[model samples]
Target chain A: MTVSDPTVGELSEGEILARILARLSPSRALLGPGDDAAVIAAPSGRFVATVDTLVHGPDFRLAWSNGFDLGWKAAAVNLADVAAMGARPTALLVALAMPDATRASFVEHIADGLRAACEALAPGCAVEGGDLTVSDTLVVAVTALGVLDAAAVTRSGARPGDIIAIAGDTGVAARGLDLLFSHFTDASGTPIAISPAALRSLSDEDGTALSRQLRPFPPVALGPAAASAGASAMMDVSDGLVLDASRMAVASTVTLDFDRQCVGDDPLSLSGGEDHALLATFPPSAVLPEGFRAVGAVRDVGAAPVTIDGEPYDGESGWDPYRDWDSARG
Target chain B: MTVSDPTVGELSEGEILARILARLSPSRALLGPGDDAAVIAAPSGRFVATVDTLVHGPDFRLAWSNGFDLGWKAAAVNLADVAAMGARPTALLVALAMPDATRASFVEHIADGLRAACEALAPGCAVEGGDLTVSDTLVVAVTALGVLDAAAVTRSGARPGDIIAIAGDTGVAARGLDLLFSHFTDASGTPIAISPAALRSLSDEDGTALSRQLRPFPPVALGPAAASAGASAMMDVSDGLVLDASRMAVASTVTLDFDRQCVGDDPLSLSGGEDHALLATFPPSAVLPEGFRAVGAVRDVGAAPVTIDGEPYDGESGWDPYRDWDSARG
Candidate 1:
């Protein structure tokens, strides 16, 4: 909005890219940016690759989530997917589509967030290549690639006697979501910009939850450690514990029986999502790795895919709140 | 409106994915779709990677382009980038974001085109994994990965005495673009649905040009062939010959001198783009690859980056058609 801070439309793509590249970490790939394509070393003969997108809107992306939050969240989500496969992320390819009227400084902040997230959560992983395009809605699509340190940990490898464990927060992000909706919405329930006073009013725990919601730090390194520890099945828990556990159960053809004591008694912890935890099944004799705690055990197929303390969880699934969220999102 | 043909909103994401998977080719990766992330083999220890996006709009995407056309173009464009790196394309990760009201059949058609393009242009390649999300506008962001057979070619490898060659059509897609605007647009210049009668009126040459524009068959195989044949530099010519040639010149710190006989006199051949051709530079004594034809030669840095018939070309660059297309696009 000021003379010094020009909009992206006022400059060329080359200029915008130069500014962004300056803020990003130097590439460590075989070939980095500025070429027709980047060449990355996938030394183990195989690489894990996954992509995820974040689209902007009032109900979807929180109004208080700035450019940095959006960039970090996008990278974090995709990195979690690669990590869930028991791989150590090495590179990322980003595709950014935004309105031309977007401020150039905002784009720079996004670059900074991407670099910071990679360094903090998955060190040695850097953005090697990307695409920039114009669109009516702002969207960030990121592809994460990593090399497997061991065999890929798939969801279908769990055995009936395996021990289920988790390595990240359960419902802290969901609690942040609660605080966001409760405190950041206007009369119409649409998200609005955060006030400094409002942000300062949160309790220490609430503030921590909100911070986790904005910039999630999924246990990236724990994925390979779990695999090395002889984990059988693994998955990234983004759609609540019970919902994702049910998926693992279906894939492994077993039942996920969670102990209430380990999983916590909070309803949100069971059905709330966006935590992006690493859930894995280890042999009964395998020692739990650092940063991991036992949650429950895999059981023979029962009447239901998931149970809590010997009974089928009769409550709604984590996805029940937004089965049609993708369809209904603006 | 029909009972059998439901919209995407009428079905769950799982149901839609099933329909799409049924239409795609069988996965060839180490571990394909359905897992947390696809495991692709990079046998040579290195993989080439790039991402590109196509957004729906009037001036950007022709209204007459169908779902199949959109999918095919998306795959071809990304393939060209990987091929330009002098590598063989191995997999594609597509992120499709469309409106909720999109028809299920349309999505299936997109899947079909994705498979068809790989089969036709780059065999052994397939859609390895992707992400689906809801957006206010339709967009396809594709990430292409490839493995180098010989060595990765780059735009900066050109040197004096290198022979410039092209492996695909030039100006043909631009011709089609001209017809698209002339025959498909209304008075306000907004593209509309194609009229069958109007299409029938085109001559053979025009028909071929239009088809190439809709579904480009870039010389994907020729890229690795050029590299193996000892090409010094290579690139994908999506922006006209002179413009992209100028880029290589600047990158290589050399001047390009094109022979009128090989490059032709048509202005479109020099300045028009969207052909997705593989352009390369080979040693003067090196035998040109089977599919390539000599178009120019490389020289030491001069006053002009590009010249024709020993004189600096006065004609405009290919990007002259849309200097600010991205910034002005919706």
Candidate 2:
């Protein structure tokens, strides 16, 4: 039966898209609606592609999070993936599905968020195309395509004794999340004395942290730079320093040693996601480029897994979807 | 508040991706997860791209349309888009968002539908990457990429005095849709009985029609063929013949004349929505390719809009999203 309005809620994803497209400017876009597929001219032959999904509740608290961040995060995560691959993002395709009752404003803000993220990361990157539908759940999926000018750098070329370096700060984004959770809880619990000054500080901190959490500044150029500089292996510091280091080790079949003390207090580095920072392994003697911070060293793959200062430390690794979250729903 | 499921849906998109990477055969994909983006080696540099969106209720009736068709349709529409661009689809990125309560089987079956469509049109094209979110509505967004060994054709290249042609039948898909509506009279009357024999005939008619409707088969090879043959301009017939022709005329600043008698019994030509046959204008001296029917002629810009037999007949030009629907819900 065609219940135009399923009791579940508002407008179907298609309805929202129809509205979005009506006002959306696709002038910069090579091809728009009414075609089988949209065509974007990527002058650069080498294109980078990345995709990500955002589920309800787990990834976002609708109460605290607005439609904007949701859209921004969706694009940001995928863009980050492309950047980590050392590519300049060119276009994005976003897919969103929701109930029929969803407010038109929500969809608009989501589009705004996507626009903001695109402008921030890749100024000209536009929403080339995507799919939208109606489902029982609220899920946002985005796939971003990028262009690599020089060459694409992978994560499997680190040579032993290479210096492990990172661009951008660490951990602050994670700390900001802690603050956000506290604010959410406090706002939900008992209204705290949130002064304007305190709020301003929180806002500033959150801007930095949220940027790291929402739209990471992936070293898109750094990847090619590292590659050109004879970087053995390279990757984005997504999960955590120690955890991601281990990934390089495994991918390169080399042991990774992290100098725990060298791990900077850059909140963007620790627990920071969406930082879009690039981490790479260079020969110990190689001169680091600006923004590079030597955090650890690559070692030989021997009897043990990755370690901190020659010892296996009992600590949490990077974010694990299955083990870290109770639910991945936004 | 984060609701932890710790089960299948609990993992973040990245986390789930990591797990998927561990299970997937790496050889099939040049690059897997954990990088900024995945690099898919398109043995050929030329690729096809298409996109389509599916909304709930309006596009489908859950009672009559199963998850299979839903999934199949999502991929088919985009593939058709790619084909329309004169590219053989090779891969697809599926973006699905639904409520948290959506059953896992529903998602799996949707993937199955995509596989089925891929197998039917061009094997090896599968859901490469996508996004998922917990939306209030169900939205399925798909972007498909294809490949072309020869030249890439576009709508801007049609020239004056070119012969207008189309591949495959048209409008049958729209007729089948009419039959569907006739079968189920807005859920107000008795549903018609579809006999087995009649069903078989209908299946053939519908298969071709449905393929046109649900899964469009674009004459991708003809794109380069037309281009190499010095086609003035090219495009796929998406909006009705009249509307799409109008588009070509506007783009090329030319008037197109069609001999209605030359147009056979293919309902799609007159009034079809998804019959993804290739429509191109070639030099008068150019020989028509296989499966393509010379339906009309291109004229220099004149006062009249695209006409049939030198006259504008009053009928539905094509589908208009806002006007076609019976109503809109906030």
Candidate 3:
């Protein structure tokens, strides 16, 4: 809208990339961004890699999230996946597809958010290489790579007597999502910005929930700590505690039972998503890591993969991208 | 269309993933798709990584390309970047964002295409991990990782006297694109399928051009071979010889002078894009790699980064996603 901030359509790819590189932290890779491909040191002789994508309509609404929050959340989610494998993230490759009409400043903000998230949540992790292309939709696809200091803590290693634990906030992001749907949309379900008066009047819990939804800061450092302390199975809780736990249980050929009191008997706590909490199973005699707290215990193969208080309690099963996305509302 | 081939929206994410995995090659990484992230071997202590994305509208037209072609092109483009670094691609992380109504069978074909490209171009590379999300527009974002046995080749390492060469076709794919625009579109410029009669009537060169555009099979293994043969600098020619050579020249602080006859005097050969050719500079005394052919030579920094027979040549400069995309046309 201003003379200084041009739409991307007015510039060249080189100019936009230069602008982005200027905002990012200096590369610490063996070879960095100016080249066709970046070379990163794989110190452990192996590297953990994963990719996650954030699409404009289905993942977030511009009314609720700014460029900064979107970028930070994107990096946080993928970094959590790497952390869940007991690795310290070292590099990121970001592929961004945006409409040509998008502003250069907005893109710079996204770059800043990526750098900030890496510095605050996963130290020494910097974006090493990336691609930019024009698209009808705005998409951020990030690949996070890490070097493991210990054996990867997979979801298939749990035993019958292991204690199930969780690190970082659970259900809070779901509640934040709940508030947005309840208060931030118009009658036809179009998102509108949260009003200043409403922001001022929200409860402390509501404020925290809203913040969690917009910019989740998962406990990244505790993953390796849990692994070092002898976690048998581990995974990030993105699709709610129950849904992700069932996956772990199925992989391990065991049953997972959570105490209703410890996991918060609320449906959202059991089925909420986007929290990026690290969930792990530790042996009976193991001391829980500093950020982890025992929430339940693993059991022998039962009728169901997950149970609550000795029963097959059911609520929302959390997000299944194909089943949950309502294009009309999105 | 049938009970066995339901739309992806009718299935859970797990079901869709299982279907895709079944269509892909067996996993070769230390850990694969079932985990939070995959662990891949980095035998050389260094890994090359890069990401590229193709969006439906600006990147391709469904009427013109099927799911298989889409997947193959995505993998081929990213693989070329890794090869350009003088490394052998080992793994790919694919992030696919598609419409909810997309058919499950279509997704499977995409997986098959990805597998086929990797198998043909880089024998050991496989899809190790990926993310699937729902979007209004179809986007395929691929991240490729590789290991280097020789010192990683970079575009900045080219010397003034180095010989410039290319290992793949330049203007052929561009001609393929031109043909589609000229013959495959309706009066209003909307893409329509290539008619059977039109397909049957095409000449051999035109047919090859069409195939090149749809499913590019870049010289993946030759990148390392070029390096082994003492290539001083290397990069993939995605955006055309003139434009990409200009980049290498700038990065090396040198100028590139091309023999128009060797590189083809056609403007498209110099300015068109999406070729995925391996372009490199080698010591004048070094024997050219098997697949490579001399096209130019590096010179001291001159008025223009790129020249034709020692003179500044002007034509189309090649694609700048930000500047070239016409949203209305897309």
Among these predictions, the greatest lDDT belongs to 3
State residue A169's C-alpha deviation in candidate 2, in Å: 3.4
lDDT of 1 at A215: 85
Q: Estimate, for each residue in B111-211, the C-alpha lDDT of model 1 and write its tens digit.
A: 98899999999999999999888777788999999999777999999999999999999999889988988888888777778778888899999998989
What TM-score, computed on C-alpha atoms, does each candidate reach?
0.96, 0.77, 0.98
Question: In model 2, how well does chain A match by TM-score?
Answer: 0.82
Best-matching candidate per DockQ: 3
User: Chain A TM-score for each candidate, in the given order?
Assistant: 0.96, 0.82, 0.98
Off by over 4 Å in 1: A1-3, A58-62, A320-322, A326-330, B1-3, B58-62, B320-322, B326-330
Over A1-330, each residue of candidate 3 has an lDDT whose tens digit, in order, gives 656999888889999999999999999899989888999998778999999999998888889998899889889999999999998899999999988889999999999889999999999999999999988789999999999888899999999999999999889999999999988999988899977898888999999999899999889999888889999999999998899999999999999998988987888888999999999999999999898989999999899999987687678777888888888867
**C-alpha RMSD by candidate, in order:** 2.1, 6.7, 1.4
Looking at candidate 3 chain A, the ten consecutive residues that score lowest on lDDT are A309-318
Ranking by DockQ: 3, 1, 2
- Per-residue lDDT tens digits of candidate 2, residues B145-253? 7665545566655666789888755676676666666653445643344444545666566655543554455554555556556566677675577767777777777
Q: Which of candidates 2 and 3 reaches a greater TM-score? A: 3
Query: 1 or 2: which has the higher DockQ?
Result: 1
Candidate 3 lDDT over B164-270, as tens digits, reads 99999888899999999988999999899977799889999998899899999799999999999999999999988888999999999999999978977798888
